[model samples]
Target: MSPSTQRITVGELAARFLEQCGVRAAFGVISIHNMPILDAFHTRQKIRFVSARGEAGACNMADAYARVSGTLGVCVTSTGTGCGNAAGAMVEAITAGTPLLHLTGQIESPFLDRDLGYIHEHPAQLAMLKSVGKDAFRIRNPETALATLREAVRLAQTPPCGPVSIEIPIDVQKMKLDLPADLSPLAVPPVQPNLAAVDQLAERLLSAKRPLLWLGGGARGASAAAQRLVKMGWAVVSSVQGRGIVPEDHPASLGSYNLQKPAEEFYETVDALLAVGTRLRSNETLNYKLKLPATRYRIDANALAHNRGYTSELFVHGDAEITLNALADRLEGRMQIDPKLAADVKRARAEAASLVDGTLGQYVKLKNTLAEVVGKNLWWVRDITLSNSMWGNRAPVLDHPRAGVHALGGGIGQGLAMGVGVAVADAEHQLGRRTVSLCGDGGFMLNVGELACAAQEKANVVFLVMNDQRYGVIKNIQDDIYGSRHAYVELHTPDFAQLCASLQVPHFKLADPATTRDTLQKALAHGNGPVVVEVDMNAWGPFAVKFAGPPKKKEEA
Candidate 1:
């Protein structure tokens, strides 16, 4: 064989492929089944392999890494239970449409799919991965390893992107293979929009007196295009996953207050609704009961998204970035949007912000304090918790498309792990940015072990643990509807100071709500590694507007 195409283990080839793909870092727990691949990573020292404490945390890290870095996030895991552990995180990646590659190990080729109870072997592991991932594949032999990896990455990075899982058997990973001469990764272009449809939509939008644009996570790549539409007097709002596509602080933006009373009222005056790259999810749309404009249009890469949740007058199947650019090109300077629309949007946003501030009650200080500290400079990562559901999701306006990273799947306990990933990405790019992860006492304890990983990596993160010592949302629901007979709501919360002490992480306690800003500043001052700030929510008092659950459906007369 030529010197340029020397024989090497498939494991080494996988590592080289990832390097060629410009993958800077990967995350997962190390295990014997996947040792070959990790060994290759270690030996080459080309890519940073983060050793997470659990497979789930590893996968979450990878997902957030992809979201923040705008690249294919790689995760490695062992076979069977290890793969199972990563399943939930993969689901989140799929929900968020993150471009991620999940590489996992499998049992030996001889024992695979035999159900013989071999060590760490799983029955139909690929099927489980398929259920959780956008797609799943397996390398049956050494010769097919590169081809399988290439296809998996392609499918993952394509439009309507999502996590794709590929399992390599232990034997195949160790087998010798000839390296390909051309190791550069393949490029998959975004789906082009249908120009005729784009022109028709542009004409319709031009005729409207008041037009609005709804952006979602898929719209992140189309920020400039979306901004142009906004500049043309189009009011804008976003789904939770879609925050920061256009800066949340933009005058015409309603932010993620889609279901708020003022925004809902503003929607009635909208003559044309162009929903771009958003699902119009049930939660944000008040279970699809929220009334929108009469003329509604949708643009998305997935053709099946047409009429999902809310029916659209027209469905344009193409990538958000591509289609919006085409539409913006035609509609520029020609739109007949109402002159008062921008002022109305501003009024609505003010009302919505007032409502949120009132609901925050004593915690409004926390929100404002964080806004001062984060200030579009740090990555805002939050898990599904009462604080996030109440205000964390909206406050502290994100200016850039990649500034916000949350659990889009509504999964709890993901913030800490995701914070590590964001910090890693921040450091990897040398952006000098830090991460502020918001968590509740309930969710913080779920994957609390990841704190060790954060400390070990010396990640730049400030974990704001809201210590209420109970499932605050559940208890609120009980109070509102279940006669306050709360069960499974109280938690045996840990002393965060002692916990962080053991982990060698700086710990701060915020008992006085007035000191919110100072406490956060001090946390950020601990610049070298991860720090935990436990907010005493019990002392902070309750929100003025109690969030029992989703809006109650009105009874038919």
Candidate 2:
């Protein structure tokens, strides 16, 4: 308890910094700039170094781990292209509102500006973070290392949790430091929901004959509140990020709803929408086509606190857990659940689900069959691809109590990596739920290097591949807009099963869709570290609704 006892090296200080974050595993490969910090920490009982096959996979695995465990997940990577390759996964963690701390090796210190012949000049990492809605900093001086570490953990774990980066220059790591570990644990102000706003929101719902409670990332820990809200009897539509925050089978919930432009009937006539946590992203709101009487009552922590004028009609500046609880309290005191409203939500949900199923029936019939065999409450992480539209529509039974994370904007090649993170989280939290992720064949190859992370760390995630030999989304666009012209989008994919085998991963190939049911069941039920079940199929259109040969007019009279 003396000042002498407090002194620790910057490397040692960094380990303690992560330990303060309550991070048990630091997943990433060791590199020159980070070797000291990573090696020193290997002996730290509170934290262990998770050796991943590649840094990107390590970062992604950490991102998912953070979301699942509610602890700041950390990953280390070498700088330059290493950091750039991490961009896709970082964007995933940010858009999904998952908390993650990424540490990347800097180009020593001298090469930062002049390039001093340092192969990797990375002065642009902070810019990258800001662009992705993440916070980042560089530690050139060992003096500020503690402060920088604290900030990274603090911001990553902040409400609307997202990724944060810290670049450690070699100089900062090896510099003889005489500083004490003044590391205070990440201190975040308790986000208390605004009761006044909750009351007003309840007022609108009390009278809304067709009110809908559309939830998203902000509703992370408010499951009980969500069930209570359903008891008040409003319809709920979930966005991609909003999908798992509430139970999919909840009677009031209308599975995961995709771009309303594609399913216009569901939202075009709603009396009111309670959009919690969702940014009302264009994809979710059909490019802001949700004709809210006015921009008044969408509840999001960021919009409410900052741009009150542009945020929501009933602004509530707090996390979803707090806001939903307050709203639940208000509803308990005020509104009586009318059987009519409950019945209406049920009818609307069933109708929408049926219409959507009919729209994409061709594809969901296949994935749902496999998902059913996989069983209820199973966690599914989707990387953006041609199959995204169909799977999002199916809202495959969430076989367990866990959240799903995906990039808000369409970004691909992250499924394998995120699975590594989520699998790590699933194991760490000791949750009994099985984890499965759907990755496009294209995405799987891009991040397949991370398979070693799963191998080395033994993350228990099963990966299912929709192995159409092309970038399916682009193929869909070219097919629709270019008269089915074959462009540069087509791929002559290598043996996908062979590819997984090369990565030392056990894989099974479904050359035909007929075997998909049994293939997925075996993969999910497999006790191996991780398995990939690749389904070979051709690319389809963008949620193509097969009409009866004729293009119907907007108003067929």
Candidate 3:
């Protein structure tokens, strides 16, 4: 190892690569199989490791982190059962399309799959990953490790983004890297949608009686584009994963379409469908049964370039930002918004507001309170609400980077863990901003161990636990849909504020809605170790309407 050659350990090199990728936080229960990687993380002062109580919690934390921060969330676990245990979350990350980088330590390379003496089903573990998405790979050689990770992150950032899992061996993780001193993280190319397609699509949108625009996480970095569409007389309907792409308060917004009824109505009324930056997945598009009329256009960077199964009159390969820009330029200040349509949308919003009392009302209040404290600059890292909300990302009624990997599908425990990652990523770029995470009691309890990571690393995080004393969504179904026959849903929670205090951190419990503002203000206003505002939201709870409106038929997108 020459001095000029900059010989670093493989684990350290891996950590450095992740660091360059703006990976500020991680989750895992350090195991013998991954001690080298864990040690590498410990040495890297810039990155923080959130030691989760279980592998599921670790996976969920990474998923949430990616969703919240618009960065690839990270998680690690031992081989075999560990990876299999994290499979549910891995599947979630894949389903949700969260950009999560999962690391699992495999058996030593000596045996070489001979089944010489394996303790668990290694093949089955890796098989689960391959079955989920294309973003899964094995890190076999130290020589190609950095470049491999580079490509993984790049693929993750691509439109129709999903998870990327890297299965590294214990021996491989320990090997020394004969690599460069400094390697910048690979940057994803900004997609530029064809202006002609945007113009044609815009024209189609203008002609619609009740056109619908379904957005996915592809619009995470494309907020300006959504705003422009709002101005162009489009009845924008954000998919569950596509939540927060637009400010929910926009009058033209149709809210999120995740249930059977509204989603059916969404597609039924559509004269033209603009499935922008989405894959129209089965869940988002509901197995593509919602029939879109002959008049519709699909715009996806991948779809336009390949021209595969996508049925579209016009397809554009480009970034939402670029496409929106192209559309704006093509529009030349021409908009076709109807006054009556705007009024109708407002009336509907008012009606929805009235129906959203009790538990849902508390969610609205939670959303509003956070918005008030964070204002325009703060980003809300959300997880539970994505695939199951009427508002999706658009419900918040505030302008911030509220795009989580909700659509990416990492794991349930990722909300707080991912928030730390996003917050750290922002801090590195001097993007001095506040990020708050709204994890339900189920979501919070899943990743409670991350609180210690926050305390240890002094991560400036404010985790607001919507402690509803139940898996409120399941409870909602029981109460509203199933004659109140609730079971195995409600939870008995520990004193989360005390939990934070025991971790030697600042904490508060918000019982009164009036005091919530002041309590939240204090938590958001400070920048020490992480703080927790355990909102005992006994007033309201969680429910599931639909993950997103039904996907349009093949002709739609």
What TM-score, computed on C-alpha atoms, does each candidate reach? 0.98, 0.88, 0.78
What is the per-residue lDDT of model 3 for residues 347-390, given as tens digits with 9 covering 90 to 100? 55555444433224445666666666677666556656332243
Residue 344 CA displacement from its true place in model 3, Å: 3.9
lDDT order of candidates, top first: 1, 2, 3
Error of 2 at 164 (Å): 2.1
State each model's CA lDDT, in order.
Answer: 0.90, 0.68, 0.66
Q: Model 1: runs farther than 4 Å from truth?
A: 2-5
Clashes of 2: 12
Off by over 4 Å in 2: 1-7, 110-112, 123-130, 176-182, 202-205, 258-270, 291-296, 304-312, 359-362, 399-401, 538-557
Backbone clash count, each prediction separately: 0, 12, 39
Deviation from native of the Cα of residue 422 in model 1, angstroms: 0.7
Better of 2 and 3 by lDDT: 2
Q: Give the clash count for model 1.
A: 0
Ranking 1 against 3 by TM-score, winner: 1
